[model samples]
Target: MENNLKNRREFLKEMSVFAGATTFLASIPWMKAFAGSDGSAMAPSDRVRIGVVGVGDRGRALLMNMQQIENVEIIAVCDNYEPNYKRAIELTAGKAKAFYDHREMLEMKDLDGVIVATPLHEHAHVVVDFLKAGIHVFCEKSMARTLEDSKWMVDVQKETGKILQIGHQRLFNPVYLNALDRVRAGEIGQITQVRAYWHRNSNWRRAVPSPELERKINWRLYTEYSAGLMTELASHQVQVANWFLDKIPTRVMGSGSICYWNDGREVYDHVALVYDYDNGVKCLYDSMIANKHYGLEEQIQGDKGTIEPEINRIYSENPPAAPGIRQLLHSIEKGIFETIPIGGASWVPETAVPYRGQIIAPYDNNDTFLQLVGYVQAIRNGKPWKNLLREGYHATVAALLGLQAMDTNQILEWPAEYVMEKDL
Candidate 1:
């Protein structure tokens, strides 16, 4: 037993070091200043007791981040898979109780919140159950598999008045937050269009482990457990577009195909979507699996400027014109010297500028930790959660609509009664 405990501690230490390295490399300039030596400004005694459900890939990552935050405790962990359950126990250094069923974990009176990292399809059911149990939830995104399920989660959240923060980590990313502020502040002028794409080379192939474990590990490739690229990848971009536009998409149209990998996977390997907002703005998005040369990119193009959140690039179409002696000489010797376009109505040159925007709440790469901190802080301060349940519902709905558009080969419209739908 002592040896087991020692090994668990060693595993946690290794995981912590790995997470720290990733967090360091992916660090955002704005977030670094906000992350103190001991994480944020929260008191250690006020730590939120957390129970994590579904200890899969994302679940383990969340566990590592939670460990870094000072005012947070992993009280319990639940996973149906025995290996994952054991792994979660090891990851938490045996500090958290383990359970096969999430319901059993939720029954623990000490837990102040829960992190739902279950498969996409089970998101709504598990989140609603925990919310109804009067426990705060931080569920991973694409919140649900279907539109009906997403709406249902929203309704239950409203009824329970519990904090339901969906895990769209990008929403809390410092760079994205900075871009959003610039968009909202009109630095990018009127956002006429958004272009986003995520491309990857090679078939999204995984080892086939005895048919049973096939669905267990790579649930993403199957429709039963996941919604493929549309939900897994495009959902993040859709949420960002929504946040920038400050409105949900009115209509969605798209298509997808399984051109690259023919591994008996039900979901498409590539997908593209066009979301039309009520204000006439549009978001064009595409994801491909055959080639990733372009990698992942998102550009918010406006009349005045463009912002690329991923690259941290911001540029203005209107640049300051040259003046004084240079302008005078060019005007005098038109034949000898070529006329340069200056900042005027007729000629505008795109020029990159330092991003001077600020995020509403600065996020570092440790956003997951910051979000957990925020949730715990809100609970301790008796304040409402900054990330509301409706946001998660909307993000999920948009993702599901994108999938529907692809499947039905028609534009999917958001129903008026979407908010009132009951969870399945």
Candidate 2:
């Protein structure tokens, strides 16, 4: 644990130099939120008491990450499902109190914060309850299953004046941090377009132990609980696009269908969307469960270069040693003055070529753990990171908008009712 802290400090220091800012860390939203009034770090002795609302897969993962940080205590765990409840209690080594109802856990006076990992449909309800109870919250991404509910969550957070950090872990990643800095520095020049996709070949389902538990265990396949690929996968990529572009799209259009997995799933298995931003920049997105060849990627394209942040590589539009150099070498070797063309016929044209990119960030850190630590720090400091919360809010609204556009088969503009007054 000591070594991990040391390495993180060194990595942040190095990235600060790379970003050409002496106060790069201080400029980050989470960092600013966690900093004291005098710009000092929080004392390690200030312990934070936290509870877990849903102890399923993602919730259990957060519990595991929480155990690694110091000066933090898991005071309570809640889940209605017996198996998950038992597993969570076991993970806590029986030290934390157990509850089947989240409302009961909210009665604990000492609980400072809660990690809400319930299904998408329950996010608005559970998160609203916690915020109204005067507890800071770290809820999973996409905010809620519906746009109105998502907006309500944000409004309640404002009314309560409590910290609400949505689960957009990429915002805390070192590689993404460096990439954002580069994009801001014009390394990629004016952003022309962005392309992102998430693909898988498997039927997105879970093994149900009993027939009645199908809805409980496989909630992601039902529209009542999930928005399928759009909210589950595209939300993250669209958040990335918004963060790097520093602007939100004015409108969205898309189409979706249950093309491959037709096992009575309520949501689409395939979706393709186009988000039109200001300055005529567009973000293209697609996902399907029929093929895994392309896997997943968020490709940010600009006039000068392209960045694939998932792979941590950047490709230049015009790489050094092009047709001029290569053709000269070929002509000299062949003892001819005629100009020699590169690969493929000149008239054939090509969409892509082999251009190995440079690595952006080489060091890897556990962003999940870092995000968990940030949440704890924010709780201890008693302040909310509005910028971070707004990023998640915009992404969730964009995804839900895409779903609406697909369902109605019409181009949809950002709704006036959902827009925050501060944004206007």
Candidate 3:
């Protein structure tokens, strides 16, 4: 009995600190990760009780994943929208209490933590109050709608000493982890540029059941609730660039226009941004709702090789030599000049793979579930990740900087206040 319980505890601890926690699970496409550990679940009384606020699309998905964990019980769900509330409670099979007002749900003293999936603007209040209530909080990314609120989150977490984790699943992704390891190891020669994009073909508008709910349903399309593509899409890659380069962007410039989707939307349909780092490296990002041709990607380019992390492939500029036997035969047959025969087709260097190339990891990367697994485990241990706060804060500020640059039509330097701890 003691051994069994000890093993379970060990596994739970592993779940918390396993960098690229799901790399192995993601590589095994045939297997499903129902829960992270193999040992028996903790007794009901010993389980971690959690609540979820704002059961919108992202929130509901988090609840669904949270429900699958073995010893974590979702105690409550709060969503102002009836449909979203209905959907979330149904996932809990009505075992979890439903509330329209988050204030009421936070009153549960026994709740160990809560997932704050509220709209961008609502985050500061929802998260801060939960922190004050002494509940570990897992808030969704784009920390807050404005810069001051975003920084306040980090400050409050430090002051309160509560577990605060931001939802940027890729930080726990195995593919990115392995790629990050390689980049730092000089796998790709000195890093030069990072390019990222997320493009889709849709008007980006939600159906308004009534005229009153137009802005509420599609909060992502308005400046009041969101920063559009910068917040919605580019934020992920911005963090990746920062992580890979080990520095925040020193300055940023951007532009946008409502090119295709003219459906009474305040945010732009197309956007472009360039963020420069001090070391002559730059992170280039662009997004458009008008085209689906270029789906999404974060491509990191170094002098010797390029890693298209989204697809997991690494391409090389200088390939390795072929097998000695094959090389000997080819050298003899082609007279050692490495030349094309007369009257033959064009001769070209071999592709990247036939020499120095590989997938960052041998798997399809699905990291969201693993990230949540880490969060639940963190709550159990009463300690959160050190980098999660910074990942969420800096990336968000970078996105807001892009928005400011676009709005003002000028290159914006990284704020001096933010630059105090680190060189810009």
lDDT of each: 0.73, 0.85, 0.80
User: For residues 1-424, could you state the per-residue lDDT of candidate 3 as single tens digits?
Assistant: 5675565456544543444345543332212222344436555665889999998889988988786666888989999999999998898899998999988976798899999998898998899999988899999998888888888887888889898888888887767877877787788898899999999999887788998898999999898999898888888889999988988999999998899988788988899999999998999999998888989998899998899888788888766634554566678887885643442323555465543467787744447766787787677667765556777788889998899899999999999665414312
lDDT per residue as tens, model 1, 58-172? 8998877776655678889999988889999999889889898887766778788888999888888899889888888888887889887887887787788777777777655
Look at candidate 3 and tell me the lDDT of residue 88.
87
- Candidate 1 lowest-lDDT run of ten: 25-34
Q: Could you tell me which 10 consecutive residues in candidate 2 have the lowest summed lDDT?
A: 33-42
TM per candidate: 0.80, 0.87, 0.84
Candidate 2 Cα lDDT to native: 0.85
Off by over 4 Å in 3: 1-46, 321-357, 419-424
> How well does candidate 3 match the true structure in TM-score terms?
0.84
Residue pairs in collision within model 2 = none
lDDT digits (tens) for residues 2-75 of candidate 2 = 78656655554553354344255456767542333311243656878989999999999999888776668999
